[model samples]
Target: MSVIKELARIINEGVNTIQSKCDASGKPFPSLDEPYTPESDAVRIQVIADALPIIAAANQLIATLQIPAMSIIVASGYVHVSAAFATIAKANVVEALREAGPQGLHVKEIVEKIKKPMDPAKLARMLRICATYHIFREVAPDVFTNNRISSLLDKGKPLKEILAKPLEAFDESPGCAAFVDILIDESFKAAAVTQDHLMDPSTAFSDEPNQLPIQRAMHTNKALFEWYDEPGNELRRRRFNIAMKESVKFEVPGAILQGFDWGALPKGSKVVDVGGGIGGTTMALYDIHKHLRYVIQDREAVIKQAQQVWQTERPEALENDTLALQPHNFFEKQPVKDASVFLLRTVIHDWSDRYARTILTHLRAAAAPYTQLVLVDQVAPLACSEDGISDVPGATAPTAPPPLLPNFGLAGSMVYNLDIQMILLCGGEERTVLKISQLLSSAGWKLQRIARVPGNLLHKIIATPA
Candidate 1:
C-alpha cells in the first residue's frame, strides 16, 4: 500500500479502537471544550491511554504529509502571547466584568469600570486575542461576554467586608490562576533565558537550587518559594500555591484516591501526607476509606489554612481525630513515625536528585519495615515507542499501539512539559521508569506497583522497603 493509504488505515484503526473502548466502558471521551466530572466515569480510565498512541500516530502523519508549513504556522500561533492577554484580563478585566455577567459589556463600559483607564480600543484588541483562544467570547463584532471557560475567574459576589469589589471575592480557579500566573510571571521569564542559563559555564555543573534560570530572572539568590512568598510577594505565593491543587498544570488531589489502595490498610492505622498542602488529597482519601486516620504535614502557613479547612469542611473527622493537621517541614524530620503510608504527591518532581534524595531519606528514617511510601507523580514513558527498555518489576501503564511515539509525545505532554518546568523553575526533572526505580532503590525502597487514576495526569507509585 502507498504511504498515505497506510497512514489513513492507522488513523482509522485508532479511532475505532478508542470508540470501542468508550462504548465498552459506556463513557464519553474527555473534553477540553466542555466540563465533565471525571469521577462520573470510573470504568473508562484506560480509554485515554489506549487512545493516545492512535492520536499521536495520526497527528504525526498529518504533520508529515498534509500542510507541513501550515501546521508549523498553527503550532507557532498557539505558542504565542495570547496567554499574556488572559493574564492581563484576569488582573484587569475579569473582575470588572463579574457583575456584567454573560449579558455582555461594551469595551467603553469595560474601560469606565477599570481602576486604571486605558484606551477602549487597546482593551478591545486584548479581548480579541483572548477570544481567539476561547477564553472569552465575542458574541458580536465588538461586544464581548464571559463563556464557561472565562466564567471560572468569577468567584461569586463580594462579601459585606468589601462590597461589590470583585478581587475581594476570591478566585474560583485558584489552581488555574496560580498555574497561569507562574507560567507567565516565573516560568516564562526563566524559560526565555534557558539557553543562557544552560550555556553559561558558571551554571553548567551546578545542581544547587540557587543556580537556576528562575534565580536569574528574579535577580534573587533566595529559592523560588522563598523569594515568591517573601514580604510583598503574597499574591504571587498564594497563586502558585493554589495552582498546585487546581492546575495538575491542567483535584488532582481527590482523583488520586482511585489509584491509592486506601482500604488495604488495617483499621485504626495512620497515613501521613508529607508536604501536603491544605490536606485536600488526604481529605479525598479519608472520604473514601473512613476507617483510616490521616496526618497532614506542611509549612506553618499551609497548616494554618488547613486547620480552618478541616474545622469547616470535615468537622466530624476533626472531632473524631480521624484527620489531624500538623505543621512540619518534611526536610527537617518525619515527626509522625511508623505510619502505614507516607504519601508524597508532586513532591519529588519539584527538587533536584540530591534534594529529592534528602526527602526520601527523611521518609526512610521515619519508615518502619512495613511502612509504604506512595509516590503520587508521573512515571515518564519513553519518547520513541519502538525503543524497548526493561521495565522495573511492577510499574506499568497501557502499552501504545504501533506507530505512535512510545511516550505519546504531545498526548502525554504533561510529563514532558513538566520535565522542562522542573529544569527552568528549580534544578529538577521528571524521571523515566528506570530512573524512578533507581531513585527508589537508592532511598531503600522497592517498586511494588503503579496504580493509575483514570483521567488523572498523575498516578500513584506504591513501594515498600528494599
Candidate 2:
C-alpha cells in the first residue's frame, strides 16, 4: 500500500482505540455506522484532534524511511518501476569507469566489481535498462562505459553508506506511533479532565527522565531524550545529529562563520558553542581562526564524540592554547559568565516559541553588556518573485522556475523543507528572519544587525540585549 494510505490506516487505528476506550467507560462512542449525527459528532471531532500529533509523527518517520528505500529501489530495479538509470550512472557506474579510464572492464569483470553476479542474459537486460537510463554508454556491443551517474559512485560515495548515514537514526515510523500515541493522548485527556493543575510541567512530566544535558534542558520528553542519548540507538543519534549538522554545514552556520570577521576578536577572548555537537562547526571555525579560543558545550555523548574527532583529525588544534571542550546544560543556566561572543548556532530553532524565548532570556541574562550574540540561521526572503505577467504583456518564459543545480535545482527548497520535517518530528522549525527578530525582541534582545555569509549558503543574525 502507498505510504500515505498506510499512514491513514495507522491513524484510523489510533482513532478507533480512543473510541473503544471511550465506549468501555460508558462515554458515548462515535457511531461508525452513522455518517453525521450531533451525538457522534463530538466524539469524532475529539478523536481527530487527539490523533493529529501521532499522525504527523508517523508521517515524518515514514518519510525518513523512504530515503533509504528509494535509494535502494533506484539501485535495484523492481518488477514494475524502471531503474534510476541516470542517477545510477552518475552516482555508481561512472565512478568505476573513471577509475579504469580508457581500459574499461570486461562484462565478467564489471559484474565481479559490482559484487552481484548475474547470468549473461540478465546482464544484457541490465545493460539495456541502464542504457535507457543513461548509465552506460554503448562503447561497443555488450561492453559499456560509465555515465555521469555511475561516475559519482566511483568517487568513494557508496549509495548505501551515503543514504544510511543521514537516516540511520529515527527508525520508528507511523507504525510505531502507538508507543508515544498514548502519552500524547493522555496529555490531552489530562488537560481536559482536570483543571489547570494537570497542565503543569512538574506534575505531567514528573516521571519523565532528566532532560538531555544541553538541548533537553530546553525541552523535556522521556522516551525521546533517552532514545537520543542511548548508545545502542546509534542510527537515531547519528541521523538526527547529521540532520542537525547538515543545516549548519550546507548553509547558515558555515556562512555565519565564514562571513563574520573571526580574527577581530581579542586573542584570549572565549567563544562558547552552546549545544555544539561533535564540534563539527567548531572545527570549521577553528580552521578559520586558529588563534581564537573556543569552548564547546554539549552532552557527554556528543562532547565525547567531538573530542575524539578533534583528537584524531585536528590534534594540533586541541593541543594548542586555542580551544577547550566543556559540557553544559543551557536550561539550568549557561556556564560562561562572560565571553567575547556567545554563539548559539541553530540551537533556538528546536523549540516552541515559549521555550525559545526562555532560552534567549537565559542567554540575555547571562551575557555581559558588550557581548555579541551570533545566531546562525537562515533568514527567509521578504517576498517570493511574482510572475512576469505583471511586468510585460505575453512574456514567453512564463516565470522560469528558480534556477537549480544540474540534477536538482531545488536544493535550497530541500534545506527549507527540513524546517517542516523538524516541526513534525520534534516540534522544532526553521524560522524566517522576521520570526527570529520577533522571538529575540521578546526576550529583551535587539537585532543589532543581519548579514549574509559569503561563499556559503547561510546568514549571520547578530543580536544583543535591548
Candidate 3:
C-alpha cells in the first residue's frame, strides 16, 4: 500500500478500536468541545496497550502529508504558541472562561475577570492562534471558550482565589499549567540560546553542569538546581516542585507496578529513592506496597517540602518510621547501605554519562549483593531500524511499519524534545539503552532487563551488582 493509504488504514483501524471500546463501556468517545477532567475515561482508553501505534500513525500521517515548507514554518512558530499559552495560563484566562460557562465570554470580559491588564485585541489574536491549533474555541468574533485542551490549564481554583494569590496559582493545579509555564518561560529562554552555547568555544565542548545554555541565558554561574534554590527564585522553585509531581500524570495508571515485582521482595525490604524530588516515586510505591520501608533522598530544601507533603498525606508513615525523608545528595556516597532496592526515577538523565556513572557507582558501593537497582527514564531510540547493542539483555524497541520513521517520527518526539530540554537546562542528554547499559556496567552494575511503562516512552531498566 502507498504511504498515504497505509496511514489512513492505521487511523481508521484505531478509530474503530477506540469507538468499539467506548461503546462497550457505554460511554461515547470524548469530544474536543467538552472540558477536561482527570477522572474522564477517555485518558485511560487512550493509554491502553493497543492505542499507541494508532496514535503514532495518526501523528505521522499529518506530518507526512503537510507541505514541507509549511510544516517547517509552523514548527518554527511554535515559540509564539507557547508564549501565548503561558500568558493565558498565567493570567488565569482558563479560570475566567470556566466561570463564564460553555457559551463563552468576550475577550474583554476575560481580561476583566482575570484582573490583569491586557489589550483585548491582542488577547483575542492570541486566543485565535491557539484556537486555530484547537487549544481553545473561538465561539464568536472576539469571544473564547475552554475546550478539552485549553481546560487542562485550569488550576482548579476560583478566579478570585487565583488572582489574589498569583504566586500560589499552580499549588492546586494538576501540573500541566506549571509544566507549560516552565517550558515557555525558563526552558524556552535557555533553548533560544542553544545555538550560541553550542558555538561558543568556552562552552561548546564543556560537559559541566554550570556551563549549560541556561547559565548563558540567565547569566548565572550556578547549575540549574542551584539556580532554582537561589533566594530570588522562590516562585520558580515552587513551580518546579509542582511540575515534577505532575510528571507522573503522563504515565499509565499503575505504571510503577508493570516491570519489577515489588511483592517478590522480602517483607519490609528497604527501597531507597535517590534524588527523588518531594518523594513522588516513593509515594507511588508506598501506595501499592506498604509492606516495604521507604527512604526518599533529595536536597535539603526539597526534603523539607516532602516532609510537609507527608505531614498532610501520610503522617502515619513518618510516625511509624515506615517512610523516611532524608536530605542526601546522590552525587555523594550512598548512605543507605542496606537498601534492598535503589530507585532512580527520571534522575540519571539529568546528568551526562560521567556524572551519571558517578552517581550509580556510589549506589553500587553501598548496595548489598542482592540489591536491585531500578532506573526509570526514557530510553531514546534511533530514527531508523537496526539491531540494538547485543550485549544488553532486554527486548529491543519496536519499529514502525513502512513509510513511518522507525522511531514513529513525530509521534515519539517527546523523548527527543526532553533530550534537548535537558541539554538546554543542564549538561545532560537522554541515552539510548546501549549507553545506559554501558554507564551501568562502568558502575559495576549489570543490565538485567528493560520494560516499557505502557502508554509512555519511559522504560524501567533493572540492574544488579556486577
Best by lDDT: 3
Candidate 1: 10-residue stretch with minimal lDDT: 159-168
Q: What is the C-alpha local distance difference test score of candidate 2?
A: 0.54
Which of 2 and 3 is ahead in lDDT? Answer: 3
CA lDDT, every model vs. true structure = 0.71, 0.54, 0.85
Question: What C-alpha lDDT, on a 0 to 100 scale, does residue 176 get in candidate 3?
Answer: 83
True-vs-predicted CA distance for residue 331, candidate 3, Å: 1.2
- Candidate 3 lDDT over 1-466, as tens digits, reads 8888988898788778877777777777668898987667554546354566677788777788899999899999998988888788768899899999999999989888888879999999999999998999999899999999998888888889887887788774788888878887789889889998899999898889999989989999999999999998878988888888777776766687778899889889999989888876788888889999999999998888889888988899999999989999888999899999999989899998888989999999999998999999999998888787666555588777776678877778899999998999867788988788888999999998888765666789999999
Model 1 agreement with the true structure over 36-147: per-residue lDDT tens digits: 2346434345665555666677777877786778987978776455454644545456656666766678888877765455777877777888778787777776677776
Tell me which residue pairs clash in candidate 3: none
Q: lDDT per residue, candidate 2, 1-466, as tens digits? A: 6656555565577667877867776667643322223344445444543444344535444554678878577545532112333223322344345555655656665655554445544565566675665545556666666654333223244434433543422222211122222222222232233333335465433322233222233233443435567655565464444444434433423454554677898777788888787676777788778677888888777777677767877888778757788877676687687877888777777666777787788888888987888877654432244332222222211111212121112224443554543333334567765577689889888876666543233457787779
Q: 177, model 3: CA deviation in Å?
A: 1.8
Name the runs in model 2 displaced over 4 angstroms: 1-226, 239-254, 382-412
Each prediction's TM-score versus the true structure: 0.84, 0.53, 0.96
True-structure RMSD for candidate 2? 20.3
Q: State the displacement of the C-alpha of residue 127, model 1, in Å, after optimal TM-score superposition.
A: 3.5
